[model samples]
Target: MIEFATHRNKDPRLSFRVLDMTVKNEENLKRVFTDTELNPGFDKVFSFACLMWTSDHEQCLENIFKLLRSGGQTLVWFMGYNDLSIVYKEILEMKKWMAYLKDEPILKYAYHDSMDVKSDCYNLMKKIGFQDIISDCERKHFKDYVDIYDFKVHECMDPYVNKLPQHLQREYLDDVITVIDRHIKNDGLTFDLIILLASKP
Candidate 1:
């Protein structure tokens, strides 16, 4: 966490303020930089969020570019595209079951997939002039590559559910309950995916 204030800034005496920053310095910073997401901000940008959503990554890189000086550095954490696609394809098949879960709040769209969540993130960071872009997809890094929350079905359970019209939400809640017993005959745990880093280039 290298912090330097120029002559015109609020803390203008050139005194470095490391207060409230993570790690001791950049070298120590490497100890904690792992799977995360980025959010754009005006000052120094540090993210510990997941990279499952590409739009968030794009916005985070844009924020890092805007917040830092020309030589300033940022470390972004996220998953690679390959690991996510496997889970995505399975989730893609869920598109066929809309009639059973469409009225369920979380699955209102039933077909909205924010594809290219990784390639798009990396591209956005590069366009923002991040040069040390290193993608480390060599590990099981992401925690939730595919959202499988239920009461009805998986995917789009967060904002999608909250975004639905209240009256239309309950229209399909219990409908899928009866269908779920027949849906998972094997009765087992399924694997999603895990991707590593996609940083600036």
Candidate 2:
């Protein structure tokens, strides 16, 4: 995404900095920073399909707010709901998998089990001092079926699979794939996307 943004940027006025939020620092870039460190601050922040991977939604949102200049806005999009969440929850209940995944907080998506996601997010942003907040959850159905290989790679289930011995990795994956297969509907996957638009006041 950073590469694409860099290639497409034509304006000399715009500059970009990167932070790998999963780590404290990648070489010299920080995983977290303050607006004061940016001199004044950034005019906007955009998080796309990234926050779903974060375990701390509140702190992440707060960080985004702190990154922006006053009146600067932000747009964040993430997976609010997915069938794989259900699959993971079910798999976690299995005795064999439980031993490996017991300490894992596998549901990284914010409010994945919320009865009222929008309201919950709105309240969070409002409490964070953001103005003109808009939080919505929309369900989308993709045309193509989920490929097993792609699912294994993109779903980030390695943390669970890697805990077992190398010889048992394939067996564990097969078990997970079985659970995933049961959730596939009409040869496609449906996702609930959470879209948030807010401004730092």
Candidate 3:
């Protein structure tokens, strides 16, 4: 994705730098772009399908605000809710998997289960000092069969599978397939995709 973005850049004045939002520390965050040619403060920022992986939304947004120059805008896209997360949450509660996944508390689909996700996100952004924040959640319906194989290799499932013994890994994946099969409604899944557009003061 980074390579594609860089290749499509036709303007010499605009440059792209990568920040590891997963990193929570100031030093590690600085280390990523310390030697880059771009000066401090970006005019725009973007995050695609990335915020769900972050454990700290406040810190993440704060970092983005800090990276941007005054009046800089940002667009963030991420999953809102889906049956896949329900399947994963069920798997987390399974007796056999509990011991292996005891340390895992935060779900990748973190705020999706909330009763009012938009308001929650809006409040967070407001607290972070972003202006003109818009948090929109769109519910999308799918008609295709659930790809059991693809999700088994997904990052959301990998953490749980990685913690299990190699012998139990395949079985766990099979169990996930079983649970997913139970939740599939007419061979399709509904999803909520959140689009957040905001700007720094």
Best by lDDT: 3
CA-RMSD of model 1: 13.4
Q: Taking the tens digit of each residue's C-alpha lDDT, what string does model 1 give over 73-187?
A: 5655543333323332333245543543355433211112435434544556567677665533232333432224343343232223333456645533333333333343234
Evaluate model 3: give its TM-score.
0.72
By TM-score, the best candidate is: 3
Q: Measured by TM-score, how close is model 1 to the native structure?
A: 0.35
Candidate 3: clashing pairs of residues: none
TM-score of each candidate structure, all chains considered together: 0.35, 0.68, 0.72
Model 3, span 93-177: residue lDDT tens = 9888888887787465757668998998899899989999999888887765456466544534344677788889889888877
Worst window of 10 by summed lDDT in candidate 3: 150-159
